[model samples]
Each structure stands twice: as C-alpha cells, then as structure tokens.
Target: MMIHTEPGIIKRDGVYFCSSDSFTQDNLFYILWGAVYSLDSPYRVSRSYMDAFMLQYIVSGELNFVLRGKTFTAKANEAVLLNCREKNLYWADRQAVVKWFHFNGKNTLPLLNYIYERNGGTGLFKKNYTKKIEPYIDSILNEIHKKDSNVFSISHNIYSILCELSAPPAVLESPAEKTIREALSFIQSNYSKSISVNDIAAHVSLSTYYFTRLFSKYMHLSPHTYLLSTRLEAAKKILIYTFEDIETISLRTGFQSSSHFIRAFKKANNITPNNFRKVFYQKSID
Candidate 1:
C-alpha cells in the first residue's frame, strides 16, 4: 500500500529569485523552490540556527560556500549538502542562480553523505554523477509540478540516497545499547496497545527486572512511564487535529477510559484535553 506523506520543501526558481515571474508545483511530495538574484554584483546570504539539512544544485553562476569552518567554490551544476543543524555561510558571485532543496525527516544524514560520496567527496562538478542524481532532484520538481504527486516516493528516494551514502558496518558492538534501542522502537510501534514492561522486556529478550534498570539508566524512564508518555503524546495529536469526543480519543490512544486518559493528559500537558484543544485551535485560527 502506498503511504501518502507530506514532503518537506524548498523552492527552486521561486519569487525570491525570479526576475519577472514565479514557479510552482503540486505533488503529494513537498518541493518548494525559491531563489535569490542580483545583476550588478553577487548576492550573498548567511543562515544560522535552522532545523533541517540543505543541498543545493547550482544551476548558474558561482557560489562561495562555507561549511564546518572550510570554504569552497561551487560553479554551475556543482552541488553541496549541509548536514542538519549546522551553521554555514555562502555567497553568490556575478549573476548567479541556484536550484536548491531543503530536506528533512528521517535518513537526511545518510542522504547527504550518499550524495557527497557519489561526487567523490571533493567537488560535485568533477564527478560525472549528475546524470545519476538528476533523476532524484527532478523527482522533487516533478512531484511539485504534478497534480497528484506521491510524497512517499520522494521520501523513499531520499532514504535510498541516504542508504547509499552511509558507510558499511565495521563490526558488531554495543549490544546493550542496540538492545535498548530495539526495545524503545518496539514501544514506539506498539504504543496504541495495552503494553507493559514485561511485554517489551520479553521482546528484547531480557528479564523484566534487568530491563527496568537498564532502561532507566539509558532512557531515564521506566518502560511503563515511557509507554504512558507515548500514549499521552498520541492523544495530544488527536486533540489537536480531530474534534472527536473524549471517549473516542481515549480509546483510540489506548487508554482504558476517558477519565484515565484525561488524568494522564492533564499531568503531561498541565491542561485538560478540551481546554488544550480550544486554546490551541483559537490561537491557530487567529
């Protein structure tokens, strides 16, 4: 089954960069395109404290890029990938236009590395991989252009690129940490059920007593409290998006009853479900 998903976005050839026009696309995938331009000299911008990763495929002119205290120049057709939460400075020189994407959500790091490795870790222009990578970049543009583009495809493509860029495993190590991560992943996947520490411990093949200690050591919360937090988080999502009654939301989020759910929600958020919804919705509309 195809999972419909929203694409994270950056615009290429958008109003910010356009001399006389704008470009837009409508894919289930989110591809936002925008540009910055100047005629007399180079236009430069500096970004700090961002949430996602950015990769630019320069379409025209020259770009001076700074990453991790190092600077480099990228001419037309060359690309650069910035890892998440990194601060970088870049400027364009002499009539420059760039096609860029700001991508996030799951596997972004791997994708960035994959693109870098494929381009020989030096310059995107020297590696003859644009023909190979263009399809993935174009996928973003095409999805934005389409009336019904599947965002899942774009997400999958990004994940695929990440997988390619990641280094292969060296040796098996840190079994305890791996076990804990697996246990937490299981909890995240099964939070909507009546779950317990024993269930999760068994899934990870550990004694409940030992799992409890180890989990608290690593995660700073018992499995039971963790499950409660996860359920409360799910309920918060429902409360924000749906007008479903309290009982329905409680059941859907795996609480035994509305009263139980309400207590948990109030404890976590310091507000009743209805009040939380009303205040948030009111603020959103305003």
Candidate 2:
C-alpha cells in the first residue's frame, strides 16, 4: 500500500504499518496489526495504559509476561490473551520467536466471549495442547492480509482468534450501584482535573452526606477514595502517552501541587511518577 517507514517501530518482514490508515479505519470498528519479535526483546506496557485486549502466539522458543503481580509463560505453538487495565512486562527468551496480532473492533468483546464459551468457559491451551493449531492461526493472518474495507475479513479473523484464545467477557454485567456508577462515570470523564464529592453528588442529584454513605457501602470507600484512584489512573496515562513533567501532570490530573501528586502516586502505585516512567521506558526495546 506504499506505506512509509517510521523510526522507533520494529517492522516485520511481511507486516505493514497501519498507523497511517488508522484514521480511515474509524468505521473499521477495530484494527489489526501483525509483528514478529526476536528473543531478548523486552516490551513493557505503558504506565497507566489500558489495552483493548491482545493475543500472542509463540512461533518458536518462549516468552514470559509479568502481569498484575503474576507471571505467565507461553511456549512455542501456544497463544494467550493479554488482559486489559494492567501495566505488564513481556520478554522473549534468548532463542524465542513470536508472532503477535493486535486486534480491536466493534465485535471485539463478542468475539472473545464466543471463544471463551466454545472452550468450556476457559481461555486457550486448556485441553491437550498441540502444535497443529498453526493452520488455524495462519487462517487469521491470511484474512488480515486481505486488508479489504468492504468486507469484514479482519473482523472475522479477530473473532476466530478470540475463539482460539477463549477470551472472556466482562464480569461486571450491570452497574454495581446507582450512586457508585454515577460517581465512577464522573471520575472517568473528568479526572483530568481536581473533582470533589459535592460536584459528583450534585451531578447525580443527591445530597453529599447520603451519597457519601452510599458510595462507601457500594464502592467500599468515600468519594475522595474513588477520586484518587481515578486521578492516579489518569496520571499514569499522561506519563505513558505523553512526555509531560510532574507539574504539568499534577495540574492536568487535578492535584493541587506536585508534592501532593508524588505522595498520592507513590501511595497508590508504590512508585514515584518519575521512577514509573523510567521503568516503563526501560522495558521498551525501541
């Protein structure tokens, strides 16, 4: 497609860059990109970043992932779904080779659900594992290679991979509690700045005292506690996605001062903001 090469990204021999066409694919529901990684490659998840969910397949050697305080290892011919909403570290062994597909679209959730349901409510590699699933994996790659906008070949491939991985749907079916949901929604949308319980309660048309009680009962904390989590999450995103400093981040995330931001971030995430960024960058090979 006459795509231009960019610095800082590893391009596979056969895979094409999709960033240029990403905007055109908004109607695309989701996007897919393929890449092969060599051993000794370290890919760290961005701090405070949330992925749409991903699938990884080991073509050869082995890969290790540290996710949410646990370690997962996948060997050749095996595939796994990378979970969402967590900062993670992934690395390939000295001899490892891997092919990964990053997929996200309108039917992404549905596709994952279908796979999980088909696999008896578990994720992939649960049964007697075999190396013969390569053909199925190849089928997905072939579909993505089509790169057609009229038909939904890419979506189907993502659906099939979800089937192979047996990914699960969200466990939270309904909103936890009315007040809590409102508060959470407020936090997510407005976390770029300081917010207060009174502001949230007013948005939901409830008194502060009553709303605070309801928030604690359902959310297990007062509104301020939820705000901290939301603000921290936003701060993490800023650190990873942007190159702004602590003062900027503090103001953007509603912290009254940089000192306040540092204290809160260390308490919640167990690392200073600068250290978090340093560790995250250290993980990325590029």
Candidate 3:
C-alpha cells in the first residue's frame, strides 16, 4: 500500500496485521491491516492501489473520498466501503475520528462490487443508515488491540458484518419489493435464453416503460444491463470450470454468437474470454 498523507497534522492510529497464510485461505476473511485514527481538517491521502478492501466507519466529523474521478462524503455515524485496488483520494473534510480496517479473502472483491453497485456507485453508506455494524467493528478493534490473533473469530465477525451489508433494508415494504424480487428471480431463472424488457415486464404484469423505470429505480441499473450481467456471470463460471470452446460457451450463456460474446466480455473486463479463462482457471493451469 502506497499512501501519501498531507504533512503537519496530528494522527493517532491503532493497527493490526495478519499472517500471510491467512490471505489465501478458502472460506475465510482476514484483516490484512487496519488502524483507528484522528485527523485534522485538510489532512489528505492518495494511493494508486492497495490490494484489499478498506472499510472505515466515521466516529466523528466527516471524510470525503474520491475514486475513479467521483467523490463522496461520510459524516459521523456513516461508513465507507472502498475497493482500494485502484487510484483513490480521501481527506478530512472536517476534524474527524475514524475506525477502519483493510481486509481481503474469498469473494471479498465480488462482495465489494455488490455493495458498491447497491450504494449508488459510491463508498458512503449514508449517515445513520448503517449503524448496525458498529458493534462488530468495535469487536474488530478489540481484536486489533489484542496480543494473540483469534483468526477464526475475526473471520466469523467479518462474515457477520458482510451479512448485515447484504441484507435488504427493513424499510423496503411489500408489493414494490415483491415486484423487484419477482423480477430478479425471473432473470436469474431464465437469463440463459433470449429474454427482453418486454418479456420481463409481461412476467411481472407491468408495462414495459414503467418496468424499466421501476427496475432502474430499485436496482440502480436497467433490466437489460442486469440480464447482461447475469449472462456474463454464467459465462465466467463456464469459462473457469469447463474447457468448452468460446462458441459453445457463448451460446450456452445467451450471447448471439462468439463474436458478440467476445466483444462484450472484453468491453466489460478489459480481457478476452480466452485470456480470462487462462488467467483464472486454476484447474486448467494445474
């Protein structure tokens, strides 16, 4: 992790480091490093990348984050879930006290992406809206301050926090939530076929125009994009788990042709299907 901080500010931080072996374990999440810090206004940091996710909870005051040319703010009682594997900037918008951790493990990156998408493409989780995990974070801080590491307990707590993040807010009442849920189920069930906005709207008994707007409002993405994503995920699994050729895989994943599949895959992932398989298919490599 390369972090450049503005000079001439008081900073107090508590941090923890886990063993290198913890990073590669299956079904386990481990903190790589973390610290609780207090910073003054105008204090800032910039990093090209850190190979982990950073979860920071603002205990007091506010922090502003900049990622991929967009900025968001987290005031006291809010949280920041930053996928730090890219260039980013953050600064104390006011005097601030924050508890934070950096962690990575199985499914962490994908989970971070999920949260980011649902968060309206920002790191801030909205003030007072996600305070349920504050206690879990405090437990992590207690672990950080300990002499011996309880890796399993920390992993369990981290997963618990993830579960909280994954839960739909209790405020999402029925009918509307029911509609989105039904739509999601349908897409998941039939993404491997030629389904369209009209088909989905008809399935939910909604007008095409209304369904499109409702889906975007609830899902933060158009139904078409969501369907594309589902197909891409299916294709990725096939690529990783099977040695099938691109044309067959594309057809199985609902793409019109290998050419279209290749184009879409490359556009989304910046890597061709063949290369993605070669790079990520450990079974093949083995």
Candidate 4:
C-alpha cells in the first residue's frame, strides 16, 4: 500500500512474510503490515479501501478520521479500527505521532466486530484501551525492527493485542437482572430467526408491555430496536465477508424481504447494501 505524507511527516513501514512452519500453527491471526508515523505539519491520506484490518494508535497530538460518513477525532492515548473494504480518510490536525498495524486472518473479522460493537458501532476506542494495547504493539514492532521472521512470534503478539483490545469492561448487575440477561442472550442467539418482542417476552415469562419497559430500562433500547440492530449487525458481517447475493443475505439475516433489508441497511449505514459491496469489492480488485 502507498501512503502520501507531507514534507514534515516521517513514516517507517514494515511488511512481514510468514514462514511455512509459522503459517501452519498461527494461520488464523497474523500481521501483514506495520508502521510508525510522526507528523509536524498538515498531512492527509485518502484511500478507497484496504484488504486487511488496520488499527491506529495515537501517541501524541491528534488525528482526525472520516469513514463512511462519520468523522472522529483521536487524541493522545486514543486508538481506532479501520475496517477492511471501506472508503476512509485520516489526517493530522496539525502535529501527531502514531503507531499502526494491519492484520488479517481467519479470526480477524470476529475480533474487529467485537471491537466495533463494544464501542457502540463506532471504530474509535477510548484512551485507556490504547494504553493497554500499546505494549503488545511495541512487542510486534520490536520483532520487525530486529528483522525477526518468526511468524509465530509476530502472530502471537498480534493476537495478544487483539485480546487486550477486545476484553469487555466489567459491569455489575442487580439481582433482578436475570430476566434482561436471559433476554439479551436469546436475542444474540436467535436474531437470525423470525422472532419478535412478543416472542422474547413470552420466553422470559413477562407481559409484552412490562418486558419492553424492563428491556428499555436496562439495555437503553427496546427489545424491538435491539433485535433490529442484531440483525443488521449480522447482515453487515455477511456483506463484508461473503459473496452471497443480497437477497440471500437478507433471508439469512431474517429480513422479511430484500427491499426491506435494503431500506433498513441504508437507514443504519447511510449506504445501500449493493453500493457498499460494490465500493469495497472494486477497491479490492484494484
């Protein structure tokens, strides 16, 4: 990949090749590219898409990111995930330093999805998260700096970094939370089925009205919205990782019809499903 930087910026990039033996044991998670960048003047990057997941951590100063249609500012000790197969742009506000890694394998998407969902569907993670994962990134970079080709070592470090980032924050629940927890678990497990709030209420032995209120109180979303978001999330994963037709994906994600799925997806993502796939796939081909 080619990145254009302004005159005052400095960038050091490393690309890794895994050996056959390392590939056999740690093929599911590995790094493809890594870089450290420092900018003292205005700098910007525009890319249609990338074929691998990218994580950028800000060491100092600030960086601004625009993806799909959302803009985010990541300051010192902040990090962000740029999903594969999407149009995005990032630039230094004025001066910044960042460490970045590009990684992909069998387990990459799931980890990325976990991070995305945890951050409320936004790619930006909080500063404490950046602090936690920085050491793991440094370990990976150290291996590359020493010209170590031990793919297994690099892969392990990458997985460690992901594990650190994906660890869920602990939350204490009241004893009365059993119903909501069970309801949430059910939705997560059965979002691909033709299930409704009534069904969820019945499963939890509560009246629909009471159940809806309880769910809304604890989850900050009514059961209906939660189900819709769950289905949409599934559809997004399929859209990114599979080549199945839109109708097939819609059906598989429990949408009643393709048109409904398209409208719902557009409302959530600001882009139609076909256009999303087109932009991403076209960039991959190029």
Cα lDDT tens digits for candidate 4, 1-286: 5465556576545444433345544465666767787876568887876787888888889899887478889888888888857778888768888888777777787777886676566687776677778888887766766555556777787787778777765465774498998998998988888888999999999999999999999889889999999999899888888899999998988889899999999999999998998888898889
- Between prediction 1 and prediction 2, which has the larger lDDT? 1
Go through the candidates in order and give each one's C-alpha lDDT: 0.65, 0.64, 0.82, 0.80
Write model 2 residue lDDT over 1-286, tens digit each, in one string: 1122232223354563334255435544344466665545443333334556666677777777665566777777777665443455565544666666665665566656666555543233522332434564565566556545322555555545455455333244454475577778887888776678888889888899888888888877788888888788888988987889999999999899999999999998899999999888877746
Q: Best TM-score goes to which candidate? A: 3
Superposed Cα deviation of residue 32, candidate 2 (Å)? 3.2
Residue 13 lDDT (model 2): 42
Q: Supply every candidate's count of residue pairs whose N, Cα or C atoms clash at under 3 angstroms.
A: 15, 4, 0, 0
> Roughly what TM-score does model 3 have, to 2 decimal places?
0.56
User: What's the TM-score of every candidate structure?
Assistant: 0.42, 0.42, 0.56, 0.53
Task: Write candidate 1's Cα lDDT for 140-241 as tens digits.
Answer: 655544556566776665555444334332345498889888998998898888777899999999999999999999888887898898888888899899
Error of 1 at 8 (Å): 58
Return the candidate ranking by lDDT, descending. Answer: 3, 4, 1, 2
Residue-level error in angstroms, candidate 4, position 12: 4.3
Pairwise lDDT winner, candidates 3 and 4: 3
